[model samples]
Target: MTTSSTQQQTSDAFGYKWARRDSYESPAVRDASRAWLLSRYCGGDAAVLDAWLAGGPKTILDAGCGAGFSALLLFGERLRDHDYVGVDISSAVEVAAQRFAEAEIPARFMRADIATVDLPPASVDLLFSEGVLHHTDNPATTLRHLAGLLRDGGRALFYVYAKKSVVREFTDDHIRQQLMPLSDAEAWAALEPLTKLGIALGALEGTIDVPEDIPLLGIPKGSYPLQRFFYWHVCKAFYRADFSVDEMNHINFDWFRPANCHRQTPEEVRAWCTAAGLEVETLRVEEAGMTVVARRVSAGATYV
Candidate 1:
């Protein structure tokens, strides 16, 4: 498929996903997600995140801000203190605007492609793009463009999916290809069984022992939960007991429906940051993806 069409489809998928705001806006999910975000970006310290937010970043850019969920989760009421701009290519920006309005938060919402969005150079102090870089046509180029909008010494926080084990990678691609032809509603319905399977597997609450590492498939010798072993090595059937079935399905659809879900390695992500003139300060790798906190530095600056 052409890049434009792929982007449009991806945008539509997210638009549909975000429109069902209740699926993600529940208090339980928000609390859990906030904790996860703190762990990733603030070293698991709410105070640290608070201090950083209050540390005089006048203009904040939430690139690819889906329904402004992450921004609300991260900034909360502090959103009123800064010039917050939320940009997205999908219609979800409308939802985001409505949400912020309902919450009495002041923010500028723009429905524009972040990759080529026109913003004054060096105008933003903080750029937050969570799980969004990889969805762009060219992640590296998009990163460079977004980084260019940051002032020197400005910070950027983002996340991108990590390349998984061999079998999991194959399964992910296969599922995505199968869903590509379906309408949004059909694709969402199609994933219910997969979500149910995850629920079933998770209910077992069992464990498995890998006596030997299979380097070819990236399976290491260790003790893993039954569901996680399959989740990490075979196919992604996300299972979190705390999340509802629809929420779980939402997560799966987010993974499978997007035509632009790109996965990257740590080295590649670090290289992209360096090439974009951003010095990597923190790089956290998990089974799912990579979370990064970087600072914009002088062009051609040596990386340590």
Candidate 2:
């Protein structure tokens, strides 16, 4: 896996942002709560959850293990005796080490790019990556490399941003370009209006009835509960009663800071899996993106 100068720069930027993460554990969150959140993070895809709960994996790779939250939830206080490896291309690996150590989950954290990260081929049983690949310079290439790490029967779950309307595509790129050049502080300042827009929309209670799509705004025609719609459409960084202000800010920062963010269509993702010799097991597409659970297949098995 070769890294380009551009990819290195983007990795460096993410490293800085995640290094100063607000809180490793949310307020009053326990082992159970963390697990619950992880489940929700998977978009409540039952097949994926069921496979995870079946619990036969001996080695797990948290590929983009941001701050080790997913690793902690997966192995710390529940699954035991598994070799859990968390790798990231940032100082967030240090934060993950601290958090996992506190949780008594014996795990390894490495500051390495997922595309180039080293582990024996076909040595992993489960690979869990969420919200990571799309941030890379070439998501298809990265996904293929990661897939090679899994054993023939091994499985991986990937969460990637989905392609939205043309209007949304232009707006997102425009905002990111403006913010990418600014310092972290300055970028956060620039995102204040967008953040507030999200909050203001989230504050509206009750459901909205829509009869047709608003193409110009990239809003689809649907009956959206006010809060849910605000979250999915207006902005994803809205303040929540369950999250800290810093957490909200982190979400906003995550969106605008990254220099390489590529949204993919389902057809493209399917093509990737097929080329990588993977068979899709579970797939759930939400407003933000799609959550896919695929297993490596080397034989005559079909992939869809």
Give stretches of model 1 more than 4 Å off: 1-3, 55-57, 299-304
lDDT of 2: 0.73
On a 0 to 1 TM-score scale, where does candidate 2 land against the true structure? 0.84
* TM-score of candidate 1 relative to the true fold: 0.96
lDDT of 1 at 162: 98
True lDDT of residue 130, candidate 2: 72
- In order, candidate lDDTs are 0.91, 0.73
Q: Tell me, what's the RMSD of every candidate?
A: 2.2, 3.5
Q: In model 1, how large is the Cα lDDT of residue 55? A: 61
Report the Cα lDDT for residue 36, model 2: 49
Check candidate 2 and list the clashing pairs.
Answer: none
